[model samples]
Target: MATNPPSIFSDSRRKANRLRTLSLQAGISAPARFVLDDMVDDMAERLAFVRHEPEKVLVIGDYTGRMADEVLPHTASINAADLVGKHAIDLSRPFPVTGFDFVGVLGLLDTVNDLPGALIHLRQALAPGGMVIAMFAGSGSLPALRKAIYAAEPDRPAARMHPLVDTRAAAELLQRAGWKDPVVDSHDLTVRYRSMDRLIADLREQGLGNVLASPAPPLTRVGLDRARQAFMAEADEDGRVTETFSILTLSGRRSLAGT
Candidate 1:
């Protein structure tokens, strides 16, 4: 018997509720909560080049539900899956649906324990010659926030964020996962924040909060205060700290040959 992969995120944790909260908050505050929107927009724009309109599309990790909405116009049908609401499915496990003509993944791959396995499953879920496009927070992101979090516990800094995938590694993973014509691209978004609290709030609102199975204990009040101060230390002349989010996008098609 094949044993399952070691877990990184807590399966029992209320991830569904967390994602639902993110979607609800995003709908109420679109501009203030632009991360989901930005991710969907970027994926939609990149997908615009596909010549063949899909017959059926599966969208994974659509927190705001806009990705499927945008793709709906280009396809006959769309099936959306997130941790909660609509067609809720966890891509970290075997996908319930298969043979989709097109698959779009937004903001979900970074935290998976078996990223390579997830990629392989995604490809397997696709019909021959079907395509997949996935986007997530990649490497070289959140330097200022990382620094602040580290400074908060100079004695022992814990894992405040999940390890992110880089462009090169993503491309290689796609190929290893048996996808053809793999392409990996990345871009950085620099957002300015007035305070650390606001940034933390934004992360929670966007469903980017901690999902680690063995997450570190909550920081003490002193540690939090230090973090806030350290974040502010990175502020520019305008008194706003800059944080960068590196978005990596991967695209590829399943082989036509049923291997």
Candidate 2:
């Protein structure tokens, strides 16, 4: 007998978070979408490096049309959407459309509960010899935040964060999904925060808020203070704590159904 994958993520919460985050980001003059911007730039460079001139493209999770703009020169048509919203896509399920020669996904894969299924569906949505580039925040991100949470609840700690995939696991997943010429690469970016509240707000604005299936209750006042103190304890003389986000890139092509 076969069983479905564990429901590690909550789709309803994820959608709500994305909508609220998008609204919050829209109000800011300079939104915190550095990861999305960086990923689009990297995808463009990779497309040029591979000499791939795709005529039909599908871009997911690029709400600002940045990725679509990058593909405009090479693609005759571009289908763009966020994970959930107007013109949204539910990547966790099978795709309705197919035959795109290029697919670029940004920022949404990490929250998916059935990642392998999603990856396989992505491949299925591509034409033969089609290229796919997907990027997301991976493991080793938010170490400072993680440590602070632990310090705040040393005993009977709650689960407030989503699990992220590591490079090794991502490689294995790509192979399992049968992508041809699959490649997995990662890079880190460092950001400094003045306070834990600001960091949390930034995360929420960037569509990285809590989407865990079983969200923890609000931290008590004492716990929040302890967490804040612990976070600031790691701050530099300038009174800003440094945080790291590791971005993972997965690139591949689908040459055949089996591959």
Candidate of highest lDDT: 2
- Model 2, runs deviating above 4 Å: 71-75, 256-259
Which candidate comes out best when scored by TM-score? 2
lDDT of 2 by residue, 1-259 (tens): 9878899889899889888878877898887887777788888888889898888888898867876665556336888878666677888887878898899998899999889999999998899999899999999989999999988989988998878999999999999998999999999888999999988877877898789999999899999999999999999999999999898999898986635
lDDT of each: 0.81, 0.87
List pairs with backbone clashes in candidate 1.
none
lDDT of 1 at 189: 77
Model 1 Cα lDDT, one tens digit per residue, 1-259: 9878778777555475365556667566453556667778887777776674678888877655776555556436788777666677777677888988888888778877788998998988898998888888899988999999999999989987777788889988988898888989998878999999988877777667778888899999999999999999999999999999888889999889843
Per-prediction TM-score: 0.91, 0.95
Q: Candidate 1 has what TM-score?
A: 0.91
Candidate 1 residue runs with Cα over 4 Å from true position:
1-4, 14-17, 23-32
Residue pairs that clash (backbone atoms under 3 angstroms), model 2: none
